[model samples]
Target chain A: MSEKIDFSHVRFLVVDTNRLMCQLVKDILMMLGCTQVTTARDSEKAIANLRAGGYDVLITEWNLKPRSGLELLDWMRTDGGSPDRMMPVIMLTANSEVEYVMESRDKGVTEFLAKPFTADGMYRRLVSVIARPRDFVSVKGYFGPDRRRQQIPFEGPDRRQQKPE
Target chain B: MRNKPQFIPNRGELKRKAVNYKTGMEIKLDEATLKKMEQLVENSSAEFLSETVASLKGLREALGRAATEPSARKEVLDHIREEAFQIKGMGGVFGYPLLTEFSKSLHDFLKELEDLDELQQEIVSIHVDTLYVVVSHKIKGSGGPLEAQLRASLKAAVDKAKPGTKPAQ
Candidate 1:
């Protein structure tokens, strides 16, 4: 593929209850050539920053202390959110069973990373997600400075595809 | 009678290796942690296992794509190195000493891939193949045995890189 992902522009927000996972993911993103990486230990912090804007990607662990990771993913999938309903999410967890893939697909998860991941694996997943991120609407606003509702249509070639207000 | 499945000896041998790996690693843990993990292993629902397996599959696919990128070779090798480091550190935490050792050796072997000209592609292929085996073992619920195999492979790869050792294992 001749496409080059503009590294400086891609922003990431990582959410994981596990400190190890967060740090490891941050390091992996940095290694993958991602310059902007923000981390949150829980959904509340992640959502707060997410509301504030600027993250191009969201990666969260499947298991959490206060709430389940899937629950958080469900909340983010609703109509009114920064990512809208189509934001790209990569779920990282120790749960490596087969059935969960179906469940994650239903929740709009773009990718999954089992715990004990290698840097190469993580980098590739990040590349694939960034290359084709899910675009959703944030109830509060878009990824930019303005709070204006933006629809990122992922179905066709034109990424800037619009929807009727 | 509960429907019974016939077992081939080779498959049984592989399963036996897996179980032996689990038992051997169980001895390395402290009393408290081992007990806790045992409970977790027993109580773990099938749903959790399935999710873990899917993630591993995704990771395997990612590795496959990365191997073909000749220009991204350096970046990909660095990524592989990082993976080995994480596996080494976390494998022990998760009760897999064999994986930790495997990760250590794999990380070392991956480092060698950064410089060699003639053998670089070959080394990359070996690493990816080893990774596939690891994922397959995990799916079969024999991640520990896979770890054992990986450790041996990593060690052999590392040894080959050193002076005086045979380059092929």
Candidate 2:
């Protein structure tokens, strides 16, 4: 049985310096029936808001004016103050460089958005991310009751599942 | 639900291209007319600059209106298409290749406007700004060197635009 997605009570945090972009995304999200959406212009403000909680998903620009989104993600990974990685982050970037995509993957970013995406494309990515498992812990040296790290043994003959830290 | 009736092009649609109500004489862009156009550019006045500014202001107003009202947006967009097409034809005839090229680009932007979401508005606004500068220079009779600036700005805007899944090129 397929489950119906309910976004009426969900909240999304959008971070981008462009006024027109912020408004446009807000409008599109509203059209998608999202309620209680918040927007941040820079990484600093976005980090602050992220600490405040209540955000279900984050849609952030790759190139921000003050600090880039990659820096923000790095800070979140290093900072012990944030909650255990529970929300999905969608990086909106114009950079399609292979190096950038590889960096994003290494950092554990959930997904990426290329420049000039359509409304439906944005909607679909959001839906897919929301439905996926949100268990991600970016910190290297962290072990506590909140941490739910599980190591699965490799079954295949050749492939190996790297040991957990 | 009922569908609106569609009809073929009437006498008005088939008529020759001219401001029919303005005067009975067709305004053809001949060599003499091209020379006169060149003269119009040479004797640029503050009023001419103001007139171009006024047109840009109208376009800005139309964009603002389109942001809110769907029907009004459609009407304004259609008007822009018609005006831009006319401008493109006239610019080519007058040997203003830059004007013709920019007008064609602006027309493409306007055509693609409706298919874009709100997030794309920033780049669209930048395009509008560039067009405004082009128009301003045209009015000043000094658009000879600004072509490079306009093209670079346009490329930058396009580069910054986030790619959509639908391939919004």
Per-model TM-score versus the true fold: 0.43, 0.45
lDDT of 1 by residue, A1-165 (tens): 234444445678888765655765575455434588999987778878888887766888765545567767776765366453445678876554566665766565768776555444555666556544333332322221112226655665642243323
Best-fitting candidate, measured by TM-score?
A: 2
Q: Per-residue CA lDDT of candidate 1, range B1-169, in tens?
A: 0122211111122122222322222222335643543443333323333433453354455455566655665665665665555554455334344444454555656655654333544554566566445444443333566555665775566565566766655
lDDT tens digits, residues B88-144, model 2? 433432234554555566666665666434544455566667767766555323254
Worst 10 residues of 2 chain B by lDDT: B5-14
lDDT of 1 at A83: 53
- Best DockQ among the predictions, by candidate number: 1
Model 2, B146: alpha-carbon shift in Å?
18
Off by over 4 Å in 2: A134-165, B1-169
Best by lDDT: 2
Give a tens-digit lDDT track for model 2, residues A87-153. Answer: 5677776444578776765665667775444444465566556543333432334211112235657
